[model samples]
Target: MIGKRLKRLSPAIGRAYIQLIMELDERISEISATQLQKQLKCGPGCDGCCIQFSVLPLEAAIVAEAAVAKNVNAENNGESCSLLKDGLCSVYEVRPVICRTQGLPLAYIDEEAGAIEVSACPVNFPDDYPLSHDELMFMDSYNGRLAQLNVQYCTENDIDCSVRIPLADCVC
Candidate 1:
């Protein structure tokens, strides 16, 4: 039953990418509650992150999976996103990585400077609440590994990688 739904929603022939997001979201929620409460106090109607071109591998997959799971038309969730409802994440328990980690700081290797600096999420305030040690390690381990999913989608169909369209525009 799950396999058939995934086959339809999944961009590739055999990739359960949405499951990854579902797992990560649960982990992040427990690991970053203090930070979420103190700094990333985002409430309803604060979807600044959604407006930008930042579709993490798992996020795109869950939206796709939700559509297929529901037999939605147009390869769309038809609800902006299966997780989103009235400016809130209805599926917060199994929300996507974008929602879980969006309210946090991001540190990346500075190729030029060779240093790691804190880059806060546009909707988050890391200066007020820094991430813990375990959180950093978990994020590091979760390195952006969705590049393959993109390649798989492109190889399977005529997917436009550069298209960063809005959810409202894309949803059926």
Candidate 2:
């Protein structure tokens, strides 16, 4: 299937992506990190957000760059995401900002002022469990980032570049 316009950005474009990613990551990490409060130790194998997601060009590029840097076999392995080697994101270090900011509830920056209430995915917790307040906060923030990042990438690349599909459907 011939996909949408593959926006070919310049080096500046790549840097912009990395910058946005880094900034977003830093802010979220500051907030969510405090909220998580060492919940990670109890969250082993808890990849609740990985299976149900898609990414923007900037995001895809970030993942591709990481795969290249780490020498991940993409042509043969990208079908399921190079990061998904052991049914999980292998390159977590260079994982997209969304991956870094998943599974939390949040009060996001309102267009007006301060923060507002938001909800998290019910499935963030195990089937027999429910997400904690911190988890829900993180999930809202993560989804907001997903929406904003795609818009920025599209604007920079001179295209709408907005399409919601399976994660497997997206490609560079």
Candidate 3:
């Protein structure tokens, strides 16, 4: 379903795409928390999943912009994440989409299996609460949009978009 004009969109498209993604992520998180019978266990100072993770080039660039704006020089010396300062994300406001969705119940369609798989952080859903596909954040759509935006970005810059860099590499 590629549009005629979007095949040549600007690199700044990532900013807009990421903004919408984050807003939807927030709404999904809120909905998940309300639908679940238990409270979300993740909170401030919970840096357990903030380890080494790879992000798309567009995502890394967006995070890097936020880090620069906030003057967040946490130093990415190859330790987990460069944005982490004493177990707290220095660029929390502009954290990547994955960071925003951590610990939340979500669903992704297993392309090969042709089935929807729902999951969340172990700390969450401890009671084995039953959740339907609609009740969870469907990641396939959001991820597709992100990938599309990345392609547009790469095409605009004449670079390969498939490369994913570590979070530390971006923040530093």
Candidate 4:
């Protein structure tokens, strides 16, 4: 099922998307090592945040490719992620950006508040945890890059740039 969708995307876009994902993973690892060491509570068996979500066509295509490669036939578990099997992500290696950064300190510009706000999973950080500015991952930068790549992918694939594909639908 997913193979058909994967066929629509060019290999160049796939390589670019994978490169971006790799860079994001590297950055997350760097931050985790320097800022979140001994603080991150997320690991195997942590599925609280593993819920159904939407992704760009580029992301969906990459995920679909991974699912096909892994021979994953994920069944949507209501509100939970379809990729979850045996309490672990079956597509962990090619999981989306959101999954990669979950439980980590995220910083976003609160448009209404006109200020920067930082947040993390309640279980991962203490209420009084003194979060440094450098420790927080600014999502805007990464998201912007992802969006740009998605736009390029969509343009090349003749897909709507605004189209958001459900993660579960990526699995065969």
| Backbone clashes, each candidate | 0, 10, 0, 0
lDDT, candidate 4, 1-172, per-residue tens: 5435644557776677778888888888888998578898789999999998988888888789888889998786889999999779999987889999999999999899999988798898988998888888889878988899889888887789898988888987
| lDDT, model 1, position 52 | 27
The TM-score of predicted model 4 comes to 0.89
The 0-to-1 C-alpha lDDT of every candidate, in the order given, reads 0.49, 0.54, 0.70, 0.84
Tens digits of per-residue lDDT for model 1 on 1-172?
A: 2212222334343345555555566676665664455555566767555432335333454555554455444323343453355565543443445456665665566658976666566556535655665544145434445555555654454555454433322224
- Give the TM-scores of the predictions, in the order they appear: 0.57, 0.56, 0.81, 0.89
Winning model by TM-score:
4
- Clash pairs, candidate 2, are 104-135, 104-136, 104-137, 104-138, 104-139, 105-135, 105-136, 105-137, 105-138, 106-137
RMSD over all Cα atoms, model 4:
2.0
Model 3 agreement with the true structure over 1-172: per-residue lDDT tens digits: 0111123335479566857776676777667657564547777888888887878776676676676667766565464676788888888876777888888777888989998888777777754677665567777778888888888777776656877866765543
**Could you tell me the lDDT of residue 147 within candidate 2?**
60
Over 4 Å off, model 1: 1-15, 33-40, 43-85, 90-96, 121-143
Evaluated with lDDT, which candidate comes out highest?
4
Tell me how candidate 3 scores on lDDT.
0.70
lDDT tens per residue, model 2, 1-172: 1123344446765676567667766766665577455443324466545654566665665555555566664223434443465656756776766566566444454657665556444554334443444444434555565566667767876755675433333333
Kindly indicate the candidate among 3 and 4 with the higher TM-score. 4
